[model samples]
Target: MELNSDQIKEILPHRYPFLLVDRITACEPGKYADGRKCVSVNEMQFCGHFPQQAVMPGVLVLEALAQTGAVALLTEEENKGKLVFFGGVKQARFRKQIVPGDVIELHTEIIARKGPVGFGKATATVDGKIAVSAELSFAIAEPESRN
Candidate 1:
């Protein structure tokens, strides 16, 4: 199924400035998710990351991948309303630079699961070229009450 930003918010806990996935193009609960992120020059990171030559940070790219994977995990009936935290990242590779105006294609597949932990193979591409790829680990847990 496809999901817009609003619908994505219902599944992801992140909000403005942090919600990297702009739209979920495809999703299969407990299996995989494909999303997109439109990078802008006005983003906060660009302010300090490099004023002269702005570039999307590699770590944020990894986080985006993780968030994409989280969408797949959170949509499952058994995981709804839960939060997915980053357990670890493995085999992360930065293949190309992502710049403003670039629309990153995020894809993540849940390759394995053990209890509340899940392993995902993820990749971020721009214009059909890989910008980043990694094996991500996630730990699912209930969200803490605000009050």
Candidate 2:
């Protein structure tokens, strides 16, 4: 199934400036997902990351990858409303500098899952070249409630 930004918002906990994934192009709940982000020069990070030559932060790329995976995990019928958190990031590598106008294609597959903890294989690519790749470890947890 495909999801737009509003649907993505319902599945992901992140918000503006941090909600990296713009849309999900394909997905099989709890198995895999394909998402995308349209990089913009006006994003806040570019202001400080560099004034002369702006580049999307490598860590954020990983976060986007993880969040793409989260959409898959959280979309499972049994997992609705649960929040996903980073347990750790493993074997992460960045091969390209993502910049404004670069449309990142993020792909993620759940590699393992047991109870609340899981691992996903993820990659972010631009123009068919991988910009970043990683094995992401994450946990399903209760969303913090406000009084």
Candidate 3:
């Protein structure tokens, strides 16, 4: 099933400038997910990230990829109401500079799964060319109880 930003918010804690995933076009619990982010010139980062050349940061691109993986992981019933933390990144590569008006398509696959820790192979593409790729490690945990 597809999900809009509001539905995405129900699964991920990130919001505003940090909420990179805009819409999920495909998702399979514990398997994989595909989402997109529409880069806008009005984004805050563009203000200082080389004023004249507002290139989207590579790290944020990878975060978007990770967030795509998180959507797959968190969609599982057992992982609900949990947070997925960045455990590590392996062999990350950025091949393109993402900018305003670009639509970043994020795709991720579950490579390994063990308890609360898992690994995902993620890729971000723009106009059908890979912009970034990485192997992301993640650790899932329950949110702190408010009580």
Per-residue lDDT over 1-147 for candidate 3, one digit per residue giving the tens place of the 0 to 100 score: 689999999999999989999999999999999999999999988998869889998988989999999999999999998999988899999999999999999999998998899999999999999999999999999898898
Task: Determine which window of 10 residues in candidate 1 has minimal summed lDDT.
Answer: 8-17
Write one digit per residue (lDDT tens) for candidate 2, span 6-83: 999988979998999999999999999999999999999999999799999999899899899999999999899999
- Identify the runs in model 2 with alpha carbons over 4 angstroms from their true place: none
Q: Which stretches of candidate 1 lie over 4 Å from their true place?
A: none
Query: Top model by lDDT, which number?
Result: 1
User: Candidate 1: which pairs clash?
Assistant: none
Task: Give lDDT per model, in order.
Answer: 0.95, 0.93, 0.94
Per-residue lDDT over 28-125 for candidate 1, one digit per residue giving the tens place of the 0 to 100 score: 99999999999999999999988899999999999899999999999999899999999999999999999999999999999999999999999999
TM-score of each: 0.98, 0.97, 0.97
Prediction 3 TM-score vs. true: 0.97
**Backbone clashes in each candidate structure, one number apiece?**
0, 0, 0
lDDT of 1 at 105: 99
